[model samples]
Target chain A: MPDSSMPAARASTLIVVPAYNEAATLGDVIRALRADWPWVVVIDDGSTDRTAAIGEAAGAEVVSHTVNRGQGAALQTGFRYGLDRGARQLVTFDADGQHSSADLERLLEPVVSGRVDVALGSRFLEVKSDIPVLRKMLLKSAVVFTRVTSGLRITDTHNGLRALSRAAVEQLDLRADRMAHASEILDQIASHRMRYIEVPVHVRYTRHSRAKGQNTLDAFRVLIDYLLARVFR
Target chain B: MNAFQILGISLSSCFAILVVLGVVRRRLRPLPGAAWAALWIAAAIAIAEPDLTVVVARALGIQRGADLIFYLAILGMFIGFFVMYVRMRHLDEGLTAVVRRLAIVEARHRIEETARGEHEASERSPTD
Candidate 1:
């Protein structure tokens, strides 16, 4: 936290918030993020409700997905938009409001310092929070599989809030259309030889967050999808 | 094997084989399974019962069983092909719907962001 109070490098920081039917919390999330950073891009991912409208009201540069393209597509849209605006340090925050706004700096640490190309916010790292036992097991399994396949040594592999430098962001092409993109991003991290570090952050797992997180069945679907991709893709 | 009977089954079987292979190549993707299975079963029946071919051809006022199977194989093959074609059409529509909806949202989103950006810039102006 060397320059915790100061603005991160001359490399403009852009926050990319990917949302899917998050009309309830998006307004609050954007407002919190905008308190410090002015360039906030909210990808309203085909929400059937007023998600985009809410984001616009909160002073965020809102983009919409007419049809639901899933979280991965939304994040890709945000990332591409950030690049268009000349963002040197790009950070991704979950739309569900699970990540703490105060910990944004922690996620930005490695990226701002030029030490690591990407810095990921890990809820399971130093700052621990109440995660359901079921979620813990499912996450552990996914990280293990990803570690062995992608060859990236890091804990909390699937944490949604991650920061990437301009070089890393430009090189990382996340092609997966759905939640599978998290794993796909890791694959890019390994493929491009970008330096990545995981910093511990406080995750607020409220009732809303728990409702949004993946269950055992969803994890199984992801595993099956990954196995199938290996064979087909 | 009677020449007439062999000819009918061979023609139908060719159609049936193509349907089955095409679906299998799709890797059990969708409704093609039912159509593939049906074509295979029909081909089997045509191959197993030569007399049935004769009966069908005679019913259709044809002179031979070979003619009957040839026509029957062709019919079964068409049914499989038609069914698969319709199924693929349905899938295409679904994809179109999803894409169309997304396009609309993206357009609206760009306009809204532009308006918002102008408003924010005006507020930060020195004159204000």
Candidate 2:
């Protein structure tokens, strides 16, 4: 196991989990994360389910949205909260229980060590993740698209499992407010020229989590976002 | 000019003149008015020289000039609709953020109030 002690520069690490209708698994996810990293902030993105209540009961500082904004906006809110609390490092985690708390150490190593400004968790790197074949193809296409557009050379572009140093988080201005924000983050990483590294992490693809994954139709919106970003810039 | 050509030219001239007047009167932004004026002029040219569309269409690998114009007009309309849809979505997101901030603040305030009320109740019961 990687060292459990927090790094010097990243003493107060805050885990930001943006949840939207994941009440079924959110409590367990928060509990697991809080076990290792105590500072947990859950942005309940307007879920009709008991997501916010469950998160609050699980001992997490819950920030809730009254209306359903996308995951991107929720994550930004969490980040802002983290920043206000003076977090040295900020982590973006999924609330669907696919991301392992065990991988948190690995994901944070580079960022915490000050070797890289950002640490991205790549399931395809070394771990044997059991993602579906079609999903794998879609992810590969996304990587190629990111490379072509954002010029970010990384194995994964859309993984929610990642760590950001305080500086990196502060510099990123995320505006997509939707699924496209994943690509927008990569675009920001490239434009900001922040040193980034990909670490191997395992992602368990449960049936529910798979169902919650982005649909193929959303690819068109991502493409439009990419084109719009280029044009507007 | 043929009857169709004459009609197209007249309508385009009227549109161009109106756009100019609107821009001069500050009723419309110059950039958009200029764009509209240019579009009307282009439409007039295409209508007058019907063969030009055919040539441009062939160059673009399309069969007929009329079909090409039809496709372009449809595409432009779709693009305009999409842009408006995106703008509305953006406004909706901003509203969501504001609502979310209010929700969070209210929740925190309610929690604090409940805790304070419980503390006061316990203190008074002990005194009584």
lDDT of each: 0.76, 0.85
Compose the digit string of candidate 1's lDDT tens values, residues B17-102: 67667677885654766666676666667666867877878888998988776777799789889878667645644563465346
**Clashes per prediction?**
5, 0
- Give a tens-digit lDDT track for model 2, residues A176-233: 6778788888888899999999999999999889889877887778778667655553
Query: Lowest summed-lDDT stretch of 10 residues in model 1 chain A?
Result: A1-10
lDDT of 1 by residue, A1-233 (tens): 01235464522788889888889899999999878777777888778888889988998877676677677767777777777667888889998889877887777877888899999878777787788888888888877888799987777877988989988888976545667778888888888888988889877887888898888888877766555434433
Which runs of model 2 end up more than 4 angstroms from their true locations?
A: A1-11, A229-233, B1-83, B103-128
The CA lDDT at A44 in model 2 is 89
For model 1, state the Cα shift of residue B109 in Å. 8.5
Going through the candidates in order, their DockQ values are 0.20, 0.35
